[model samples]
Target: MYAIVEIAGQQFKVAKDQRVFVNRMEGKEGDSISFDKVLLTGDGDNITVGAPAIDGALVGAKINRHLKGNKVIVFKKKRRKGYRVKNGHRQALTEILIGDITIDGKKKSDSKKSEPKKEDKKAAPKAAPKKEESKKAAPKKSAKADDLKKIEGAGPKAAEALVNAGVDTFAKLSKKSSEEIKEILTNESSSLAHLDPETWPKQAKLAADGKWDELKQLQDDLNGGKA
Candidate 1:
């Protein structure tokens, strides 16, 4: 279970067994602090959002440490006017561990559920081995291929462009519009421009298909040409 809690005028996303650092509060090690401002609460799939804050919701946390942040050097100077000042500062911080998050002042224990016995754990069967399947067996391989090609340095928009341009595979990219390639390469920053475009396409295709040795050969070829 997790919650968005407000403490010391700051909101933090916290979960059980997680540690968070915030501006130092009035507490020593092992001191418990209850965050009354719970903006939201979530238990895996289900989430409860508050209208400002959930009524009677409280998140309990344990103070782990009181420390200081990394030292930052602040300097100020006026040229040739004998005005020079420098100072170092480290912000105080408090580390807290989220103990438990309670919503509506009630625990999340289901009345229908019962604890499993030790024998029940031992009697459980082992999981079956997962089969290694190739991209040929998956429907999303083509979409993934398109993503792999155009996602070199481009964000979501450029990825959409390559997907729309019918260049679904790296093999297709090697032969697609150079204008589109340049647009993708120049508009965004990618190493595809520095290395041989031919070798890059082949390498990407081999990697997608899990041809390790062929990929190595292409890398060697590119390096050799550079040498």
Candidate 2:
């Protein structure tokens, strides 16, 4: 059986045990969630679709995880004017497994019962160390790289070069001079010159100075302004 359900104000077609990811949602892994905005449902011979959303139909799912999507590079440039722009995006996403789809409030079973096996505690392996590994303290650790990738115009290569040049953190990036960063980029890869001239340096500077809120706000403004 299949059903179309709405989550986070968006609609999806789903089936039992099917996993899907949508816009980031406020739930932790292993949490149960329900959707009342079931738009359509069907089982072999019967079909039910809503004028907008089906009444009395509920879809239940379990949150599998909340994660970010793959990095996407956005590069913009105009010929010969030294006008260039670059950005990157890693969209937040939530993964869910559709469990049950109900029609007229009657739920369909998602699995078949299986016999339980007896536990063999004696065969269990011994537990290992739980403490985390520690590294030498890095006093120069700059916050500049906290989320340089979040700027929406950088890539793994840029990030690597930045880190290699002591711009490993967001705080460091924001504090460094634009000329310095540009010089580093030029020395590392002249290709970076294609980035948005007006905003990249400004954003990097803002991030270095610990003006994170402003940094995000500026990114949003740039996006909204179609920069």
Candidate 3:
């Protein structure tokens, strides 16, 4: 029997007693590990596939050793620009021997449900520590959010993103560079990556200085907050 399983975000085809080298896993030599992301399994003429991963399939393995892959040299140059760069890289790898492929395991399905529960549990504890901060920050956020939305290039979603990142006050927003504001909006978890923030700092400066007339005139000259 053979199974295709996911490990460290990469998939590999493995069979019993087979040795496979994969991205470094967190374990010492002789430690045992199991992967439950079995994508497919086959035995003779019988085959099973998963929508993404089979719920009750499991792949077990034992770590033989950890080692560094062979070094690779990387070279880059900009022609006629007198710029050349050279680098070397070595990837960390773990060697493991496949032990068994099993189906109809209750532990495998329970583990999948428990993984999300663990993530939710982790997020819950972090909220308590930030409660006092939320109290202190609450009053300003309400009034500041409306004013932030007035800034060029900062719509409701962009304003909310900035507010969540702690730039709720006009003075605080005014102090940030465009690059800093972009970083705040373009976070990996945020959906505001498509919004441009180039004109935000300038508009914030006007708003913080109580120059609403000037800020409006500047917005009129801008095209969707680009300039």
RMSD to the native, candidate 1? 17.2
Give a tens-digit lDDT track for model 2, residues 99-139. 98877543332121121111223442232111111222333
Better lDDT candidate (2, 3): 3
lDDT per residue as tens, model 1, 35-154: 878999999899988878987788888999989999988666656889677778787788999988888543333322233334345755332112224434565655456454322333
Give the runs in model 3 whose Cα sits over 4 Å from its true position. 106-227
> What ordering of candidates by lDDT runs from best to worst?
3, 2, 1
lDDT string, candidate 3, 1-227, tens digits:
99999876578999999999987777889999999999999999989898688888999999999999999886666578896777787878889999999978647677886776676677777765576688878766575554677876666657767778888878898899988988887782234565677778888888888899998898876756865
Residue 208 displacement (Å), model 1:
63
Residue 24 accuracy (lDDT) in model 3:
71
TM-score of each: 0.43, 0.47, 0.49
Ranking by TM-score: 3, 2, 1
Residue 9 in model 3: shift from native, Å?
1.3
Alpha-carbon shift of residue 215 in model 1 (angstroms)? 61
Give the count of colliding residue pairs in each prediction: 0, 20, 0
Candidate 3: give the clashing pairs.
none
Lowest summed lDDT over 10 consecutive residues: which window, candidate 3? Answer: 188-197
